[model samples]
Target: MSLFERFEKSFMPNYGTPPVALARGEGSAVWDVDGKRYLDFIGGIAVSSLGHAHPALVEAVSRQVATLAHTSNLFVHEPEILLAEKLLGLLKDPAKIFLANSGTEANEAAYKLALKYGRREGRRYFVAAENGFHGRTIGALSLTGKKAIRDQFGPFPVEVRFVPYGDAEALREEVTGECVAVFLEPTQGEAGVVPPPDGYFQAVREICDSTGALMVADEIQSAIGRTGHWFAHQADGVVPDILTLAKGLGGGLPIGACVGFGEAGTLFAKGDHGSTFGGNPVSCAAALAVLDNVDLEHVQKVAAQLRTGLEAIEHPLLKGVRGRGLWLAAVLTSDVSAAVQKAAADAGFLLNALQPDAVRLAPPLVVTDSEVQSFVDAFPKILTEATP
Candidate 1:
């Protein structure tokens, strides 16, 4: 049996069966086991910000692994400290970080903070927007608004109230002092890269402040220059009390963080929370490499260019394009996003159907103008074949 067959037989049925068995990747491209090369627009679900086989990431990981790989949280490491300091330096003051192994773990740490903070204020409820995708863990899953992901895992701990996304009035009416936190994503990535209404984040920030509730922005998919900003909340001129980050933060390594600002940072006592492999030196080193080599200017310009190019496409079946920067969702007039995804893949490109009506694209930040042109060049043919 092949690797795919072996994987299907050995692994749990949670992810279903993957279509391809990838062998290797370089830059914004990958090759399957069958040697079929593809323009990797999905970017490993937006995690490989600098693209696969980036020299910086490889060198850093190699050096760190040769020096030190795993050290329990018992001892201090330079990479972890430097990463925390560097990340905190970019944000507003009085920020503290809790590291984890993945986005769900980061959200789990934040959830612990909320539960502890709620106990202090005698509150047990958490508020979040509808269609929001936080993570797959139990605590994060509870805050997630998607019914399908949560229907099987019932009886979550926190009482969660789902408000209509981008509706400030609904948030204002729903948020109470008894609420622990109001969670939101600046752009709902998994839900077709939906960008919230103008001033929505600012309004949510105000609501959270006035109601003595913590505002938690889950930027696992939107942070790390994905939206042409260090943090998507920055675009809205709003800052959250707590932020959860993963996906692109480690530049393809498994790392997640729960960052809290001001007194919120002190909520977690020494024994409150911890993770064994949260801040592994190799992961931290790789993340530093990504941050060091990332060209913010280039990422911003390329994303703008892509948006313009995609919008200018004269395809009738293409309804609209939503989102900012490299993060984008192509809205189709008909519910044929899966067909479009397959068509793109068959034509030597890779993309995702985030929803039946929306196909999402999050290419590597290093994707060049030529690559953008190639996708634009090939997109028409792909859509023409997919559209009925």
Candidate 2:
């Protein structure tokens, strides 16, 4: 019986019992309450782009908090403006950004953008992909097609249609001119890190264009250099009318944003949408630190190397590996993902069970080749130990 026991007694059961209680983190590693060190591969679910306790992030947050910690939405902040410009600069198209506190908030804003833009006539429906995870907020959750998350949170907004992932024909058949938006994850992260079929996004873009439906890409988990690109959709050369970002955007801080490009950007007028803590100076500072450190070229090179090393791991149980850059899914032969996660934790490595048969590895952008080599060396044994 300890702090963990007390936590278990008091906390809600939504997340069940978290396996490890991390006390401190530096670079790509962390230590638990029991003083056990671990090489973090999940990067706080791809939130720590510059890794925990990065000096720049720490200094930026510190300076900003000391200067101006909280500002009401009434006043403008320089950091917020700078962050918006930086984020929009990352996109090829001119865009307007709406900041928020998390991924769901970003998606929420995107949903609002769609509705606002579609309200021009009678268009109001949103078409999303089945098994896609947007966010848990009322509006964002409405667009999320996964029944597991949406089942109990019923009585959601109407006019949402879910099509099978990567099925362009299905999307074209389901979404019509009356649909205001088409929402999808560039690569489905929560659904076992499923990558869409080649040329699939192009088809989606075509459908949205043909029907006047705005294409919305939920890059909450796939963007911010996680998949060897500023945004995953860039790799496919397909652009979306709206893009949502969070997770790694603010480095370790909490900040999310919905970016609307070209005509979509003009849909939201002043006073149309707002958030108090969305563009806080401290969070914007942290995000700037992340952007400064994460050079796209360097990340791309490192990601290619990491992928090569992971694929080189010769294990029979490792059925296959997918995804780009540090965002990867090591598919296992069986449904021992829980066991694998436990064993990896015990062995001083951190991983995630995105699905029963998929192990997600999204290490920090700063993770080195040496660390990837170490994980590759240890992976086979860990797989064996986790296997029943």
Candidate 3:
């Protein structure tokens, strides 16, 4: 039996069956079990920041594993401590950190922290943007505004006001004194890498201040120099009270962080919450390697090249491009993004149909200029083949 057959026989059907089984990879490229090579523009859905088989990440993880692997929050590890300090330094604020295993867990941590803050302050409501995605976890799902994934599980106890993304006035209107926090993504990654209008986050900051609501920026997809900044909100020159990160942070290993500022930073008292494998040494070391290697200027350059190349293609299916830096989307004239995605795979490329109208292109940060040009040259033909 093949890999798909094995998967069907043994595994649960949550993810369905994967189209291709990748065996090995090296720097913006991967090979399937059939030995077919493809340019990996999807970058494991924006998780492979330094591309595959990076020397730094491999060495760090291996070395740390040899030294120490799991401490179980029963003891401290140098890598975890160093990783925390480095993240706080990048944030440049007085904040506390909680490490976890995935973006969902990181978001869940922030949600729990906000609830604690709300209990003390007498404000329990939250404000979130429509089409924004937090995670699949119950508490995080309650604040997620997308209707499809959230409909089955909720009637959640938490009251979250749903508003249109990029509309600051909607936030100002919904975030009343009774609202304890507002959850936002600088760029709505799962909603097709959608970025808001200029000065939107600044307006959100002011609104949160006015209502005494904590502003939680979900940077799970937009942070760690992917947007040519350490964090996307930095582009708007605003700081959130709570920030969550994961995805690219571990360079493919599982790790996540919830960073809180000011009062929210100290909201969790002892014996409140903990995860057994949260800050394991190996993952922390891998995160450190990713941080040390991500180059902001290189990200800006590669992004510009890819954007210009995509815009230059004269295809009816492609409407335009949106997003900043390495995080980009090819907006289609028709809702044929799935066709385009399949066409790309057939043409030896890998990307994502993030929405019906948007194909997300999040190549690794280290994607070469030649690779960008190669995709550009092939994209026109790819689109031509995909058109209905």
- Quote each prediction's TM-score: 0.98, 0.97, 0.99
Return the lDDT, model 2, position 268.
84
In candidate 2, stretches whose alpha carbon ends up further than 4 angstroms from where it belongs are none
Residue lDDT tens for model 2, 1-388:
8877988899998888888999999999999988999999999999999888989999999999999998978889999999988887888688888889999999999998889888885896889989999988889889888898897988887678899999999998988879999999999989888899999999999998998899999999999999989999999899899999999998888999999989998898888899988888899989988988897776787788777877887887788899878888989999988888988988889999889998999999998878877888888889999988
Query: Candidate 3: misplaced stretches above 4 Å?
Result: none
Give one digit per residue, the lDDT tens place, for model 1 in 1-388: 9998899899999888877789999999999999999999999898999999999899999999999999979989999999998888777567999989899999899888988888999987999978999988899999999998886898997699999888999999999889999889899988889999998998998898898999999999999889988888888998788999999989889999999988889999888889999999999998888878778799998898889999999998799899989999999999999899999999999999889999999999999999988998899899999988
Candidate 3 residue-wise lDDT, 336-363, digit = tens = 9989999999999998989999999999
Clashes of each: 0, 0, 0
Q: What C-alpha RMSD separates each model from the true structure? A: 0.9, 1.2, 0.8
The count of residue-pair clashes in candidate 3 stands at 0
User: All models: lDDT?
Assistant: 0.91, 0.89, 0.93
Evaluate residue 220 in candidate 1 and report its C-alpha lDDT on the 0 to 100 scale. Answer: 95
What TM-score quantifies how close candidate 2 is to the native fold?
A: 0.97
Least well predicted 10-residue stretch by lDDT in candidate 1:
85-94
**Which is the winner by TM-score between candidate 2 and candidate 3?**
3
